[model samples]
Target: MTSAAKPEADQTVSGQLRRALHPGGWSLRGRLLGQLVALVAVACVVMGVVTEVGLRTFLLDKLNGQLAGSIQRVDSPIGGDQGQLPLGPPTSGRLRFLGGGAGTAIVVIDNGTVTDAYTINQQNYGKPVKLPPDALAAMETVQVGKRPSTVDLGGSLGAHQVIAVASDRTPGRVLIVGLSVVDINSTLLSTGLIMLGVALIAVLLTALAGELIIRYTLTPLRRVAATASRVAELPLERGEVALSVRVADRDTNPRTEVGQVGSALNRMLGHIANALAVRHASEMRVRKFVADASHELRTPLAAIRGYAELTRRSGDKVPPDIARAMDRVESESIRMTALVEDLLLLARLDAGRPLRRQPVDLTQLAVDSVSDAHVAGPDHKWRITVPDIPVIVPGDEPRLRQVLANLLANARTHTPTGTTVEVAIAQLDTGEVRISVTDDGPGIPPSLLPEVFERFARGDSSRSRAAGSTGLGLSIVAAVVTAHRGNVTVTSRPGHTEFAVHIPSED
Candidate 1:
């Protein structure tokens, strides 16, 4: 590799390693398992490297000692002066004097020229084998008096640990001794393979055991999550809610990490339940107050209307202003009575007072409501579309009729004269009877669409109070529809506004 390319390669390898250690989008459990495995792998690699290095060092030291002994025996006076043999073919006699075991190579050099070179043939029971010229030439590079050196003498001699020394008997003669390190290399290879296999087995066992332990430890957290999910699915926004869901008792022990979380969650749920109970109690009290106040005001309002009418017609000619004042009083009393009735009805619906349920034909109800709207607002165009067959739904007849009447009244009061108002009733394929009131006037403002059915929700410009809009008509429609187990929705844009109600069919 070129020098400039080396950094790029190193960066690539480092990036790969970093990504493997901290992969993106890993879940908590996956990250934990990966860290555990990576730790074990690093420890195993370190152990293998240390074991191989230490074993090679010990083996090499022992081989060097054997090399020293071979040099002592070959250079001994018992063999011959200068340990020099005849400059001829290597013989068994020379092999016996070398003393080192098989696979030892020795060379005799005289005055910078090789005189004899041979190695012991281990396959032939320690017989001497003459070294090739190339192998002898490779050994000649070992420096004289050096401690030790490793030389690769190619062609079956392989690598050898060699040392050279000058002759004491002859001034110019040199002795070079080498021993094959093939056995050391083979031993190291075998040990490495064994260590690798054992490390892999250990890692596999650790992974399995760690996974089991983690899953068992997280079981309580899973249960806590399931409980929270169930609670989330409950209808806790309205009415009297029974917030009964809670973490299991064993899971909320507070002794473990997940247990601590579970305990805190249970405490939070308990507080919310208490708050919901309090809110429901407060709402009930308010509803009762409104219902009682409305019931009590009926008698006094009736008396006021009766007295004003009686005073206006007492068989005596009265001033025009006084008569007109009596007329205003009667009209206001009538409007106030209607407002009280609406409030009482809303209170009863909030208290879950059961309504009379019977199969009512929605087609007939739509026609009647549209007819009443036409009579009330004769300047506006009114249209009704209903199926030839009566589409019946199980609900309170009076309440359903009131729902249609309010929807039509809302369109008539808000739209300009001559604006078309349509009433449509049909049975849907989903076993629902749908009633829709659509108008082609200046549609409701987009800001008011969300809370159009809320109590006292009215537009400021187009739907003014001068139109006798108390802002409770739509609220009454919503309450009555909800009491009958139906849904109401409205959509409005420039030039179009629609109110749709869907009630489940009896069938």
Candidate 2:
């Protein structure tokens, strides 16, 4: 994405993230479970560090004590032929320890030159190794009856702590003993590696267990969310809102946080449902009043119009103003009758009354409606297009005729007198009929196109009361089409406006 699109993509990703997480801003369950696993991992790491340190300390202490004891045990027998001593217990079965463990080294130097050196590691045999100059120099610092001093034996003998003691048999000689500590370090390093591997495995297993347990514990919360989502899809905006949806029984317990939310939502829905009931009842009463009032007014309105016409035609030398006033009265009564009829039709449709269903020749109906439009809007150019074959549909012929006439009359009345209005009827191969009324005129305002078919939706103010328009023509058209299981849509932009209706075709 470019810099401009990056923010849009980021917003999309963020929205997806929010939808994936719980209502608590992020993944509450995962966060809680992860913290629990982290606690276990920290404890494991601390234990590993402590155990490693303690084990190394204990091993080193034991090695140091064994080295000191080995120093005391190394002695040459009096008058022996060589540097030989009586054999000790040899507790180490595999190690030829004259007095110490496998990997033990014993070195004895008298005056400036080394007199003896022996080493053993994992076998019941001792081998001699030459001492380097560094070992000689370091050992030269130790004195008899002094504490054993630790020093590096520098070359391949590794490092050691050496002790110098006076020889018990030889009169003029001093005994030097050195012990190597390489085995102690090697053992500690190997054991620490094992502990580290075990710790990592333990942490992984703990995380897995924690995730499973947390998800299982949060099952009721998931059900609560599901119930809310299902309820959100309901169409409760108008009419009687039968909000019968509720949280599942398994998730309705008020002892938990999720349960509390579910209970609150249920209470809110109940209140909204009650309010919707009251509103729907009020609307029904208003519709009933309009229908009854409109029905009762018809007879009086007709009688008044008849009397006004009779008085105008009385030919008893009535004044010109009185005659014109009578004509106006008759004209207004006719307009009122039309308005009342439209309202009664709308009220019936709203009450879900069924429309007349029968086979009607749509092509013939279109021809007749267009002819009537041409006569009514003689100043405007009108055209109609239909196939030669008869097009039939199941509908009320009079109502369907009214739907088409309303569409054409709406275009003619709203547009300039010379604007061309074209009505085209086509039967699609998909078993539907499409009828469109298009005009070349100043189009509907962009803001009003969305609600043009709504009752009393007015525009231009000039057409508000002109030509006896009730502002309900288009609404009645939409209602009649919808009753026949059809749909109507309009698109209007400058200089072009089209209204299309589609209905199922008959065989």
Candidate 3:
């Protein structure tokens, strides 16, 4: 392979190995259970291997001992002849007397020539059968005076562990004795199979028990996670949040690892609850202060406007500059009064004061608000679109009318002259009423869209201060709609701006 191709192939193999080792998206419980099962399987495999090796060694040693005893018997003096080999067909009798078992092969090589070669055949009633030439040839290769070695002799003799020893009586004669190792092989095979079966059973039991124990151990952690999820779902950005969700007392025992987590979660929730209480208390104080201050400022603001108008019409010859000053004073007083009224309304809404519920006709409200906008901003074109059938929603009539008025005033004040402002009201199929105010003009800046409905939020360029905007019109609209359990949203781009309010229908 090329050098570049080698790196690619290596990378592919590495990636495959990584994926095989660490599969993605496995949960904690699954990972723990898998590790436990893998560990048990590995241990079972190791134990089986060790036991198989030990058993095979022990069996081989026993077979070797039997072979040694056969060699010792072959060398022992028999029938008053000092280790002289019996000749002819009587070799089978001599071998039986020497304790040779079935499948045992015996070979006698005298002066480099095999004289007698035979094996005990148990099927033939202990009769010795003449060994085949191939069996004798395989037996002659056995090393003399060495440890028993396994050799395969073809034609039904199979394999045998044989040892060759020099004859004591004859200098050139050699006796070869061997015992079959087929039984030992069969025993080891059976033992290996049994070990595998037992190991599999043990691994299965371990897996089952581990799964149950791991599940039981992680139950408390699951409960703690559930509590945290519930807390996250709560609306805690504003107002008095109850913050009542907490880990169960039993789960928070602080003994086990999961219990410690549960305990920490409970303590954290307690701190959050206390913080929310303090925040609600601070918010309450601010709302009360604003409501009281606005209430107190109302009377004095009314007096200032009344006195300014009264002086302007007193028929006294006033200077032109003084008349302008008086006019400015009355206009600013009116603006301040409007600001104070908006603040007071926001305070009441923040206090969660309930609104008066009644079936109010949104079509009529749209028409009246548009007519008022036309009078206020004569340079801007105003239009209203309402269904032929009236759309009525259960809400306070005054508050709903104010919502439409504020929306229309906002459109008129923000857009330039000749911009067409359209007021559209419709009853939706989902049992809700929608009031949308759209204007074809330079839309609100993109930066201000997120907080457009927040108090005193206004664009510096599109929204003009000379139009006497109190900057709380949209905020008031949002507060009143929220009090009636409705929602308001704004969308703005270059040439289009729309403010939509959705209120659920009474029916």
Which candidate wins on lDDT? 1
Off by over 4 Å in 2: 1-43, 57-128, 131-215, 429-431
How many clashing residue pairs appear in each of the predictions shown? Answer: 0, 0, 0
> Which stretches of model 1 miss by more than 4 angstroms?
1-28, 77-111, 116-159, 162-176, 304-332, 461-463
User: 200, model 2: CA deviation in Å?
Assistant: 5.3
TM-score to native of every candidate shown: 0.81, 0.74, 0.82
lDDT of each: 0.84, 0.76, 0.83
Q: State, as a TM-score between 0 and 1, how close model 2 is to the true structure.
A: 0.74
Flag the better candidate by lDDT, 2 or 3. Answer: 3
What TM-score does structure 3 among the candidates reach?
0.82
Clashes of 1: 0
Candidate rank order under lDDT: 1, 3, 2
Query: Which is the leading candidate under TM-score?
Result: 3
RMSD of 2: 6.7
- Tens digits of per-residue lDDT, candidate 2, 1-507, equal 011234333357777786666446558677877688789878887988898789867866776676666655565343343443333323111112245444555545556555554544444555443445666667667777677666676656676666777766556556666677676677777877887788788878888888888899888888878877887898876656677888876576789887888788888878877888898999889889988988998899999989988997788888889888998999999899889889998988876688888998989998898899999989999888999998899988989998998898888888989999999999999889999999999998867777888898878656668767768998998999888888998888778899899999863
**All models, RMSD in angstroms:** 8.5, 6.7, 7.0
Model 3 lDDT on a 0 to 1 scale: 0.83
